[model samples]
Target: MKNVILTQEAPAAIGPYSQAIEANGMIYTSGQLPIDPATGEMPKDVEAQAEQSLKNVFAILKEAGVDGSNVIKTTVFIKDMGDFPKINKVYETFFTESYPARSCVEVARLPKDALVEIEVIASNNKTNIK
Candidate 1:
């Protein structure tokens, strides 16, 4: 069976998609924008944008009983490649020394024209991810 992951700590999905879904032993999260769940606002800078995006991704993982350590892979989308270094600095604060595999690409634009967006695939370590 498939389990839907939802959390108020993360921003709500803007389209017809769940925040994340878990099946078997894996949890796949939708691309998370930088919009803050509480303020419904996106930060202006790339560093803050990356932080917010990761926060959203983690919130979904938290709902599914997982965390960054359980993440096997990640895909990041950014509006400008030049902002990569700044984003990386913020991203590193969220993970440990042994980081999950990641791929980041420069995109022309994001959903809210935000500077960054992120998504993750994590392993559900517990028996029940309710």
Candidate 2:
């Protein structure tokens, strides 16, 4: 059975979508904008935006009973390629033990004009150390 994941620790979905969904021991998260759940505001800088985005993604993962090490893949969208270095630095802090396959791209725009957005797919299994 599929399960819809929700948590107050993360920002509410801006549209008609669950924060994440889990099935068959896999968890898939929707792209997370840098909006803070408490403030409902996006951070002004790319580095901060990246961190917020990761925090949001991990919050959903946590709700699905997993952690960063469980992530198998990641997709990051950025408003500018020039800020990749800054974003990468912040992204490094989140995934400590193992790195997941990742794809990052520059986009013309993003929801709420966020500087960075992130989403992840994770393994929700016993070996993942939730």
Candidate 3:
């Protein structure tokens, strides 16, 4: 069975999509923008934006009963390649020494003109919950 994941700790989906979905021992998260769920506002810089985006992704994962270490892959979308270093710095703070595989690309734009967006795929293999 597929389980939809939702959390108020992250911004609600603005369209026809769940925050994440779990099926077959895997949790797949939708792209998370930097919008703060409390204020519904995007942060001003790439570093902060990346932090918020990852936090949102983490929240969704937690709601699915997983964590960053469970993640196998991630995709990062940024408004500028110039901000890659800054974003990477923030990204590293989230995962451990064994990092997940990642893909990052410069995008023309993002929802709410966010500086960064992140999505993750994580394994539920350890807990075998649902």
Candidate 4:
């Protein structure tokens, strides 16, 4: 079975897609930008932007009934490679020892010209409960 997840805690999708989809025990989330859900404003600095992006990802995860620890993989897109260290610092604060696999890449540009965007995949850990 496939389930679509949505939450007001995260910014509403600006296009035609759900925030996340849960299927067969896994949750796949859309790329999350730094838009603050409360104000719909992007943060100015990379660190703050990264933090907000992760918070958006977390909100989608929570709507799927999962948490950060459940994340199996993540992909980060940054407009500039120079901001990797700053983004990594904030990203690291979210996960612990069993960190999820990740890939970070620099793109020429992104929707809304945002500095960073993050997308994630998580599993329920419960094989029989999907």
Ranked by TM-score from best down, the candidates are 2, 3, 4, 1
For this target, which candidate reaches the highest TM-score against the unseen true structure?
2
Clashing residue pairs, backbone N/CA/C < 3 A, model 2: none
Query: What lDDT score goes with residue 53 in model 1?
Result: 94
Per-residue lDDT over 2-78 for candidate 1, one digit per residue giving the tens place of the 0 to 100 score = 98999999999999999999999899999999999999988887888899999999989888887788888899998
Task: Give the local distance difference test score of model 2.
Answer: 0.90
List candidate 1 stretches off by more than 4 Å: 127-130
Residue range 1-130, candidate 3, lDDT tens digits: 9999999999999999999999998899999999899999888988988999999999998888778878999999999999999998899899877789999999998888888899999998765322
RMSD of each: 3.0, 1.6, 2.6, 2.6
TM-score of each: 0.94, 0.95, 0.95, 0.94
Model 4: clashing residue pairs? none
Candidate 1, residue 125: how far the Cα is off, in Å: 1.4
By how many angstroms RMSD does model 3 differ from the true structure? 2.6
- Model 2 bad stretches (over 4 Å): none
**Native-vs-model 4 lDDT?**
0.91
Per-residue C-alpha lDDT of model 4 across residues 1-130, encoded as one tens digit per residue: 9999999999999999988999888899999999999999999888998999999999998877778989999999999999999899999999887899999999999988899999999996633222
- Which candidate has the highest lDDT of all? 4
**Taking the candidates one at a time, how many backbone clashes does each contain?**
0, 0, 0, 0
